[model samples]
Target: MGGMIIVEEGALRIVGGLVDGRPVAIVQEADDVLFRVSGNSIEDAVAVARARLGAGGGVPSQRAPVDVPVDAAAPTPSVPPRDLRALLRAAVAAFDPLRSEGVTEGPGKDRYRKIYVAGWPALVHYEFLPSHARRHMGVELHVETEKAAAVTGILPALCAVVRDAMPGQAVVHDPNWVGGCGRLQVVFPDTATADTLARAMQQLIVLTRPRVEAALH
Candidate 1:
């Protein structure tokens, strides 16, 4: 089976402070492996990791190539098939940077990943909005704390921060969100690739983690 490989900066053991290196994670049927790799960029790190695994920097196919005669009469489709699950997996792989910052990814439903933000595990919701004229696919990052005090104190501030940063998108606070705890949510159109989703999550982390830290102290 083709393994799930992840390349991220820094080690998992070291936290709270900054780590100054890159790490490659390879999870397969044989074994789960993680090791440091020397590189300036993720691409470089991936290459090194691929070498270690005896991979040629491409996804290994399960089946071997078979010779077949081409049918020239067959009509070629205009667009290729899109695999949402594969895209989600790619998105998770792109979120390697978040892992270093203690933003662990848990299981998610259908099209999104469950991302931990500011110590609160929230779902990265993928909604199908038929009402919208354009960009029907909506991606929302909803963060909430179970602590009652934080709902009144932190969520509003966090909502405001997201609203101010992304004025074009919808940002709201739902008091009934996630059972009873208040949730701060920021929504945007899902028009980009997996890398873009990872970047958006990282950007949100950068914007709100400081306030979260201050509230904790």
Candidate 2:
């Protein structure tokens, strides 16, 4: 109300200004008041309108202060909060440019793409799966070769190496694929920092690439 306000003839029309780039509108009838505020609950919208009106004159003004106090507004987020995909992307981007390049959004919203590890035939993939409150990060190595049987045969040893290399990480050999294709996958909780995840992925590739190349040969 201190900033600006507007009033209409129908019922009790109170139009609050924009808070955080979202408009807040309040309409009061004889019994109850209805509020429409973007990104905020009805109670919050009413509180904001009342506070603004009290601060300024009872008459609504065109210019109203919509900025809520920091304490009263939504809580601030921690760095790299629960967005595993975004964190993975940042990690790949910060890795050595020569070895890895091109981090783009994947086919799905929860996936990241174009993650290239040095000496690896195919680009790596990262995806985030949410289960309840926990978030899981999936790293995949799509091993495509003419000798699909050979690649499939070495999956056990490759998985063993991956398990040893990435302690506490879950490694699986996913055989479900089209012709001449398989995947070596690793899933782990996304609790580590971006740099840590990036290093883990790079090391995983380094440990497994030789085995894959040998199988191809």
**lDDT agreement with native, every candidate:** 0.43, 0.49
For 72-139, candidate 1 gives per-residue lDDT tens digits of 01111222334555655666688665554566666565545666644542432212111122221233
- Residue-level lDDT for 68 in candidate 1: 15
Model 2 regions lying over 4 Å from their true place = 1-81, 97-110, 116-134, 144-147, 177-180
**TM-score of the candidate numbered 2?**
0.47
**What is the RMSD, in Å, between candidate 1 and the native fold over all Cα?**
18.2
Instruction: Please list all clashing residue pairs in model 2, or write none if there are none.
Output: 3-63, 3-64, 4-61, 4-62, 4-63, 4-64, 5-61, 5-62
* Per-model tally of clashing residue pairs: 0, 8
Worst 10-residue lDDT window, candidate 2: 70-79
> Which tens-of-lDDT digit does each residue in 1-217 have in candidate 2?
2322334333444534334334455544322345444326433454565554453345554444343322112212232336766765665565445243443333444355445434334422333222223344555666555444666677667776886676434455565534535666665444545665556666766777667667655
- Tell me how candidate 2 scores on lDDT: 0.49
